[model samples]
Target: MTSPRPHERLLASMMRALPESGIVLFGADSVFPMIAIFAARRWGKNLTVVSAVNTIDPRPDFLPYSTMDPPAGHRGSYVIPMAEAYDLVGRGEVDHIFVSAAQIDAHGALNSSVIRMDDGPDKRLPGGGGLAMILRTVSVVDAWKPVHLRRTFPPRVDFVTGVGNLRHVITPMAIMTMEEEELRVSSIRSGDTLDKVQDATEFTLQLTTKESGLSRAIAEPTAEEIDCIERVDPRGVRYATEVY
Candidate 1:
C-alpha cells in the first residue's frame, strides 16, 4: 500500500496517454519503451510495440532498461528491418510514436543535436536518428523528458531536429500540448503547480484564458496502474533515466 514514487507516477501517466490499440513505435530512450510494453501487456489493449531495435511486438518477460537490450526482443513475433519500419511510418501504418529531446521549443520542435553556449564551446549531443522523418510521418508523436527545467523547455530550440505531429510533451512537472502550432500547458502533474511549471519553462505559458486548458490536472496513478507498473518493472528500470 505504499504510495507510488515520482518515476512510477510519471510512467503511469505516460502509459495512460497511449492509445488503446495501435502500433506504438518507441524511440531509443530507456523509459518510454518500458511504458509501452506495460500498457500492451497490462491492458491487453491490442497494442503493438515496435522497438527501436526493429523488433516487432516483442514480448519481453520484464521491461528492459534499454530497448536495445536483447531481452527486449526475447520471444518476439517478428523482426523487421529498420528501413521497413520507417517505410511503415511513411505509409501511415504506425499509430503512435514516443520520442525524447534534450531541448524542446514552444513550437514543439525538438533539439537533440547540439547545445550552443555563449560562454563555452558548443556542446554536441547525439543527433536525432530518424526523428525528423518519424515525427513528420507518425500520426501522433508524444515526447518525454525526464527532467523539467527552463533550459530543457526553451523559448526556441537551438536547432530543430524534428517538429511535425508532436501532440504532447510530457515532463515530470507538466504535460504541454500543441495549440495553434504552439505549446501550451495542458495538464499540470500531480503534486505540481502552474507557478512551478511556468517557472521551470522558458517560454511564456498561455494559461490565462479558460480555453488554454490550464485548469486540468494530471490524474494520480490509480492502484491498478501502480500494480501494473510494478509488475512490469520489478527491478525499477523505469527510473534508469528519471531525474525526479
Candidate 2:
C-alpha cells in the first residue's frame, strides 16, 4: 500500500476547527491533539494545551509553547477547576475550548466525560476542565462532529458536560458545522464527494457551503507557519492515527 500523503494525513485527522483564541484539553498521548497543537501553533492563535497530568517536551523545537512540569500521572481536571475555566474565557484569555469526545450527537454535544464501566453506573471521567464553561461562555468552539466521522454519533448523547457551540469538527471524511443548532456538512474532504462523506457519517446533514473542500481558514500558508508544521510534523504530514 502507498503511504498517505501529507495533506491526506492533515485532511484526514486534523478535523477540529479552532477559535481565534482558547484552551484545548486533550490527552498527552492523543495523536489528533498533537496535530491540533502543531496546526494551532502555525495559525499563530493563542492557545493553552491542558493535560490532566504533567507532560515534558523532549524535542521542544516544534511547539510554539513549552509544556511545564515533569513526568507524572493523575486523573480528573485536578490542575484546574471548571469554574476557573469560566474565569479564563471571561477575562479574554480564552475564547474557545476543545475536548476529545467518546460520543457525539447531531446537535454537536460531546460525551467525553462518560466512560462505560463493567457492571457499574457508567463511570464518568472529567472530560476537560472548561468545556462546560467554554460552551456557555465563549459561545463558540471547533469540533469534528458525529463521532469522529462515523456511527459513534447518535440522535442524543449519553451525557453532555460541554455542549460546544461546535464551531467546526473535522472528520476523516469532511468538515462539520453548526447551521441553526443542527450540525451541517460544510466542507467535503478533498478527494471525496459530498455523498461519499455523507455516507461515512452517522447523523443526517444539510449542505450550507457553496465551494467546499479541504481549505484552511487562512487558505495560504505563511513562510513561518509552513516551517513550523514541517518541523514537528516533518514530511508535511499530520498524525491522526490512534497508534501514534
Name the candidate that leads on TM-score: 1
User: Who wins the lDDT comparison?
Assistant: 1
Runs in model 2 with CA error above 4 Å? 1-16, 19-31, 38-59, 62-86, 90-92, 115-128, 145-149, 209-227, 234-240
What's model 2's overall lDDT? 0.53
Provide the overall lDDT of each model, using Cα atoms, as 2-decimal numbers: 0.79, 0.53
**Candidate 1 lDDT by residue in tens digits, 55-122:** 88887787777777778776768898988888898888898877888999988899999999999999
What pairs collide in candidate 2? 15-170, 141-167, 143-168, 143-169, 144-169, 144-170
**Local error of candidate 2 at 93, Å?**
3.5
Judged by whole-model lDDT over C-alpha atoms, candidate 1 comes out at 0.79
Candidate 1 backbone overlaps, count: 0
